[model samples]
Target: MDVPVLETERLIMRSFRAEDFGPMSAFFADERSFYYGGPLSAGDAWRRLAAYAGHWVLNGYGEWALEEKESGAFVGFCGPWKPGDMPEPEIAWALLPEHYGKGFAFEAARRALRHVYETLNWPTVMSLIEPGNAASIRLAERLGATAERKMEIYGREAVVYRHLPPDLLKEQFA
Candidate 1:
């Protein structure tokens, strides 16, 4: 399935592209990528980038590459990802450090949750955050998620934050 594009007032969420490789590689290689299980080698980054594209092909729904609308910069990724038996479909986001302070993550995430809750009409969605990632935990809270529990995902212990349902999201954001 072709990836669909989503837009907010300041950002455009679209499919990953080959040109995204360099930035993606840099992102994965950076020490800041630690919370995300990154700091990957170039080859690992390539395979990971390939997986992002393949995810769309296999699932018909997955992460969207976030672009700044004004400059068309590749900021990061945000969308729904459910890698088989994941307990639940997860609304995820990862932005380069340069884009961190801006509201891009929140704006993009609001749209992503909308896609999952309203478009896909899923009842509940989650954000799996590493316990040590203070930034992401705060972001998840701002996105109206609450830490439901701690569980092992892919052999690593992480906190699972439950996002509000569509109706509640509407009321919260309205």
Candidate 2:
């Protein structure tokens, strides 16, 4: 499946491109980005971008580069992905530190969730967030996700949050 461009009120979520390298590198260089994605050097960021592009070919769906609509600036990335060790589908997002607290992450994430549920027709999606990542936890909660489990991932203790399909949520939580 060809990756499609997604839009939100003030952002565009699109596939990765070579030009995104610089901004992507800058985002990764920030300590906050590593808070969840793990630390990456500039070279690693380029390699990661290449891998992200390949994910589209290998899995048919992958992360989308988040860009600001007004400034046309690359903010970060948000989309669907199945990390190497993850057993189930997951939704992920990260934004430049400057964009934090601006609702960009939530807006981009909401669009990604809609695509996963409505377009991809996924029955359920999960987010594995570090216990100390309060901002991410709040965003997941706002999206109707509930704490499902707490487990170790890549040597870190993480909390798994699940967003059930609308019907299932009603049936199970009603």
Candidate 3:
């Protein structure tokens, strides 16, 4: 299935394309972008983007390149994917440092979560965040995700946040 393009007030979340490589490479090359995810060389970032795009063809869902609607600029990425060893599907996102503190991450993430739950019909979605990435952890909490456990991913310790079925969470939290 083609990943659908989603729009928010200030952003457009759409599939990756070759034209996105330059801005994506710049974002990936930034140390701030790698603060929690780890540094990646330009080549590595390009390869990853290629793989991510291919995943859309293979899995029916993949990361959407987040862009500013007005400026038509690539800002970052957000969507769903299953990591190589992850036991459950995950909703993940990252923003270029310039876009931080502007609520872009949260806005895009909310749209992705809605797609996962309402459109994709996923019963649960989880975020595996680096323990030190307080910003992401807090964002997950604000989305009604609960910290489920601590686990290791890509050799780094991470806190797993889970958003269970909305009805189930309402029944339990209510």
**TM-scores of the models, in the given order?**
0.97, 0.91, 0.90
Better of 2 and 3 by TM-score: 2
Total residue pair clashes for candidate 2: 0
Q: Summarize candidate 2's per-residue lDDT along 26-94 as a digit string, tens digits.
A: 877878775556568999988888988888888888889998999999888888888567888789888
lDDT of 3 by residue, 54-84 (tens): 8788888888999899999888888898856
Error (Å) of candidate 2 at residue 112 is: 0.8
Taken over the whole model, the C-alpha lDDT of each candidate is 0.90, 0.84, 0.82
When 1 and 2 are scored with TM-score, the better candidate is 1
Model 3, residue 44: displacement in angstroms?
0.4
Give the 10-residue window scoring lowest on summed lDDT in candidate 1: 82-91
Off by over 4 Å in 2: 167-174
Best by TM-score: 1
Model 2: residue 142 alpha-carbon error in angstroms: 1.3
Steric clashes per prediction = 0, 0, 0
Give the higher-TM-score candidate: 1 or 3: 1
Q: Which residue pairs show collisions in model 1?
A: none
